[model samples]
Target: MEESEILRRGLDAFAELGYAATTMRELARRLEVSHNFINDRYGSKEKFWRAVVDFALLDVQSELDHRMAVGRDDGERLRNVIVQLYRLSAKASAMNRLMSDESTRDSSRLDYLHQRFIKPFWDSIEPTISSLIAAGRIPDAPTHIWYFAVTGPALALAQDPIADRLNPAASPMAEQDRNGMADALSSLVLQGLLPLSRGDATDRNG
Candidate 1:
């Protein structure tokens, strides 16, 4: 089988079983190949895991870069970025699951994923966010808080089994539902970030 096909199966296995539970034999079984074939090609499970992450993240970074490039203004850019994230969460649910699971512990794999995928995406968007803040388009809030507010819901939605169990009515499963939720979340985020009126601002400052 092609390496890309192998990596795709590996991604699903890792996402479902996580790193510790996944094995090369299991992956080979999923791929309908001999275990020796997998080991011969990738050499080790760790290398296979790295290859999977690399494959998934390359697509993510490309899509995000394309979406961010299409906006005409900072506000539009921010909205575009948020929409892109929601779309990615829906499409690449496995990637979301894998990252979230890994993030709870401190590991070299987590660091590698952060430096390669997460950091670059954040660095790319930071300028647009800063520009909006500088222009007083958005209220001054900590960067991390803003990120959470924008990303948290969509990420939650990606884990739909948990989300559905928690609240089936609000869980986004269909494309239309996902788009509607993304729109509502984007509006809420933008509204929260809008500059407060002078009286309110002054009152808070005082």
Candidate 2:
């Protein structure tokens, strides 16, 4: 079997039994091969897990690229970007859950996540935000704040649909709540930035 196939089967095992609970033998069984086959391909379970994480992040990157290509103004772009990013959160949350469970008290997985997934995501998107700022689509849009506003609810939205329904009073954000959430975040960004554009400022100060 291909190395990619081996990683795919390993990820399936991780999803089924969780990272900590999943073993190479379980993955080999899923692949219809001996554990030695998996070991020979990936060298160890950690390496296999790392491959799975990389694959999932590539999925996220592909989705993000598509969203960026859809062409929208700043507000609509933010909404679309957030929607796309949040959509991937389901798979990401599963990976995140596995990482946390597998590396309990060891936090190395968290570091791995930042390196393997989060940083690449940030690097890809940050320049887009810069372009938006240069085009007067957003003003003073700090990357951290923008990122937090757009992506903060990813884990909760992916992991807890019922919690969103049960507590609309406090946390009214479900996985399907993308439209409203997008509107709210878009409004916040546009209202903050549009007023600071050159034309708007000239009108105000002239």
Q: TM-score winner among the candidates? A: 1
Q: What stretches of model 2 exceed 4 Å from their correct place?
A: 1-6, 15-18, 29-32, 91-93, 99-108, 127-148, 160-206
lDDT of 2 by residue, 139-177 (tens): 666777876655555644444457666867756443445
Q: Which stretches of candidate 1 lie over 4 Å from their true place?
A: 166-181, 194-206
Q: Tell me the lDDT of model 2 at 202.
A: 71
Candidate 1, 73: how far from true, in Å?
1.7
Q: How many residue pairs clash in each candidate?
A: 0, 0
In terms of lDDT, the best-performing candidate is: 1
